[model samples]
Target: MKRWMQHIMPPGTKCMCIVAIVVHLDFQSRGIGTALVREGTNQADQDEVLCWVQSSEAGRRCFENEGFEEKERLEVDLDKFARGLEGLEERDAERKWGTHVWKYMVKFPRQVD
Candidate 1:
């Protein structure tokens, strides 16, 4: 867990954390992720608990569409972590390595009518 998570959700807080949501490459961009998030959000709403997720760049839009607000962002340098690895140069020649961003997001439970 990250520091911001602790700040937002202290011990014993009534909250739900979405650890991961993965869609197959062939199934991506087809509302699957959004549906998954919606289901989770609906559950949280029913339970009257806060919902949280750590979203990747690819999943940010989906999470946002599902009503998750960006609370914080973490940027990691992939190149730095990959430095001195065997065949890195060859891999870099084929593709570029740069920063990867993770967005910390939260959605409060919606009030029922």
Candidate 2:
């Protein structure tokens, strides 16, 4: 967690990090990802803890829709990792390997009345 996150989650506040959520290709765009995030948020709310996740591009929207806000981002170049690997030339041509972005997002527990 970054120092600024202290403002969102005061010192000693309990926190939870959701590492990953993956939906099958055939099942995507059907709200499954949103449902998963909702479940996590619900649990965090019940426990009164802040919830967070490092989300890929595909998962960013789901997390956002679940009330998570982007706090930080990390970008990695795929081409650098794939360098000197055979057969990547053709694949690179097809997709144009580029930077992959990961966003660190957080959602504070909803306040109770």
Clashes of each: 0, 0
Candidate 2: pairs in clash: none
Question: TM-scores of all models?
Answer: 0.83, 0.78
- Candidates in order have lDDT scores of 0.86, 0.83
Q: Which stretches of candidate 2 lie over 4 Å from their true place?
A: 1-11, 85-96
Per-residue lDDT of candidate 1, residues 1-113 (tens digit): 75776788877879999999999999998889889889989999999999999889888889899889999888997866775654666646545466899999999999966
lDDT per residue (tens digit) for residues 1-113 in model 2? 57546646777889988987989999999999899889889989988899988889888889999999998888998877775654666646755566899888899899755
lDDT leader:
1
What is every candidate's alpha-carbon RMSD to the true fold? 2.9, 3.6
Regions of candidate 1 where Cα sits further than 4 Å from its true position: 85-96
Candidate 2 global TM-score: 0.78
Could you tell me which 10 consecutive residues in candidate 1 have the lowest summed lDDT?
85-94
